[model samples]
Target: MYVKFRKSSRVFLITVLFGMLMILSASAQTGAPINVRGSITDVAGEPLIGVNILLQGTSTGTVTDYDGNFELRVPADGVLEVSYIGYKPQTIPVNNRTSVLIVMQEDTEMLEELVVIGYGTVRKDDATGS
Candidate 1:
C-alpha cells in the first residue's frame, strides 16, 4: 500500500508541472504588453500640442507634451486613436514598434463656423456729459 501511494503522488506531481508549463507557454504566445512612444504633428510638420492619444477600444490614453511627444504602455498588437480640435481624427496601429510619428490633417468643416458673445452697455452720466 505504501508503494502504491508513492506512485500515485508522483503522477499527481507530474500532472501539476505539466499544467504550469502549458499556462506559461500560452501566455508567451499571446505576447506581453509593450511601451510605445511617438510624436504628433500637423501636415505642415508643426508639432501638435495637447493632442489626444488613446488606446483603441480602451480608456487608457495620454496627451502630447509641449513638443507634441507622447508615451504610453499598450498591448503588443494595439491600435492608437488620435484626435484634436479642428483636426481630423486618426487611427494608427503600433505593429510591435516602439516608436512612431503621426501627421494629422485639418478638418475644415469643423473650423468653418465661429461664434462670439458679448454685452454692450453705456453709462447715462457719461453719455449726457453730466
Candidate 2:
C-alpha cells in the first residue's frame, strides 16, 4: 500500500534540489543591472570624443560619443575606468550613482625624442653623430 523510491531516484532528487537551492542563492546574492550615465571632459571643459570607457574587471566597455556622453548598464555597485590618449586614466566608482561627470587631466610627461648635433637639433632617427 506504499511506494518506495529506488537509490538512483533518490540521488537524482537530491541533486535536483541542491541545484535549485544554488540557483536561488546565487540570484539573491547578485543585483539587477542598472542604467548608468556619464560624461567625460578635459581640463579645458571640452568634451572628449572617443574615450574608452570600460567596466572594471569585465570585458564590457563602451566609447564616448562625439559629445563625450555615454550611457552604460552596470550593476548598482560597479567601477568604471575611463581612458584616452594624452590624458591620465580615471577610475570611477559607481556606488549606486546613476549619473557621473568626469574631467580627465593631461599627462605631463613628454615622450618626444631629439638629438643635439654639432649644427642643430635633429630627430633621434636622423642623428648619426657620435
TM-score of each: 0.74, 0.67
Q: How close is candidate 2 to the true structure, as a TM-score?
A: 0.67
How many Å off is the CA of 67 in candidate 2? 1.1
Q: What is the overall TM-score of model 1 with all chains considered together?
A: 0.74
Candidate 1 lDDT, 3-83, residue by residue in tens: 999999999999999999999999887557899999999999999999999999999999999999999998888899999
Give the number of the best model, judged by lDDT. Answer: 1
Residue 94, candidate 2: Cα error in Å is: 1.4
Per-residue C-alpha lDDT of model 2 across residues 1-130, encoded as one tens digit per residue: 1234577788899999999999999876665678889889998899999999998999999999999999999887789999886678889988889999999998755224555557777667776754
Go through the candidates in order and give each one's C-alpha lDDT: 0.87, 0.85
lDDT of 1: 0.87
